[model samples]
Target: MTALGLLYPGHSAEDDYPRIEQLLGSDIRVDVVHTDIGEDAHRVDALKEMGSPERLAAGVEQLRLTGAESVVWACTSGSFVYGWEGAHDQVRALARTAGMPASSTSFAFVHAAAELGVRRVAVGATYPDDVADLFASFLGAGGVEVVSVRGSGVITAAEVGEWTEEDVLTLARQADTPTAEALLLPDTALHTAALIPTLEKELSKPVLTANQVTVWEALRLTDRRVNAPALGALFTREPIVQV
Candidate 1:
């Protein structure tokens, strides 16, 4: 069986991961490995503390034990707060420690955008404007253009994690525009994996959410892909032909 490891930071809306696992069914499994987080709030200094290189390295060994072929650092803020190059080093550390393919949620958004041929994109985030801006920068560094970004000013993932599907849909409409090829919701704090299809329908453009892209990137690293339309348009891409 194919398995992708998700190295989750504690401050995430974790329910989203299992939902993806269930939707993907038994042929593939998403194994979640966690790192320490001191508090659930989104203070920059505090978040930085949660994702130290040592903690990330610890999680990699755990995921390797669980038989995960590839791993994603599953928190957006947890990685992006480190800046673009910093996030790259974070994943390199994970791969170096685990001896497997590795990536982070911030990079996942970049990879997902490339999959859909999206360059200029709008962002909707659960973080305060300052925190959210860093993500837009991360995307820009990775060669995806950031058309615009609207932050919800949410102080905690605990709060965003509780948002109803209606709330996510509303954010999609508010964050998207005709100029952008797609909308990016950048927070694992928000439960968005199940809402991807509806968000795409409402905007008539692809929606890339944190956990959704994290899972997609993890699968891609494992040299596997799924064609589940129910999960969202991202899954409907033509499977990568192995060399």
Candidate 2:
């Protein structure tokens, strides 16, 4: 079986492996190796604690040791808050560490949007307002037009994981803005893989969740094809362009 590994830290709110399994249904194996984000919690007091290359590299190496075909740094804020170069460097380090393809949730989201040829977006986040704005700027740098951004101001990744699909739908609906061609739920902790189709139908637009994009991009690196309806438009669309 093909294996895709995830290197996650702390108590993440948007871990979606279960939903991925439910959507893909045993076609692929998804494994996660966790690290303690609690100790580094203070690093992000002002959303500034996101760029820890040393810590991130360590996590990637650990996951790589498990023999994954591909690995991803499954955190949005953790990768983007460092700015463009920082995010790029982090991916490079991960790829080197794992001796395989690597990507982060932030990069995956941008790649997914590019694949859909979407420029304008509405960002639905579960971060504080400040962090949400940071993500907007990050997206802007990636050639995506940030139409609007809304956040739930929740802290602690574990809590973000506890949010239900109904909760996410409510947030997603509210985040939709007039000029947005796509709605982005940018939290890896939120279970977006399951609710993507419902959100797209309700909003009449593509809904991009962090985990959905990450998985799609990771699989793309390995030449894997996915045709799962539960993953929504991300899987239903054409394959992502190779970089």
> Best by TM-score, which number?
1
| Candidate 1 wrong stretches, greater than 4 Å | 239-243
Report lDDT (CA) for all predictions. Answer: 0.85, 0.79
- lDDT, candidate 2, 1-243, per-residue tens: 778888766655434776685677576878787754644332254334443666666676667667789988888888888788878988898788678988888899888898887889999988888788888988989999998989888876667778887899899989998789999998777777767889999999889988888788778778897888778777887755646
lDDT of 2: 0.79
**lDDT string, candidate 1, 1-243, tens digits:** 998898887744888888998888788989898788667767788777777788888777778888988888888888888898888888898788889999988899988888878879999888889988888888999999999999998997778878988898888888888999999998887888878888888898888888899999999898787887877878887633434
Model 2 pairs in collision: 10-37, 12-157, 13-157, 13-161, 13-189, 14-188, 14-189, 14-190, 15-189, 43-49
Where does candidate 1 clash, by residue pair? Answer: none
Candidate 1 lDDT (Cα, 0 to 1): 0.85
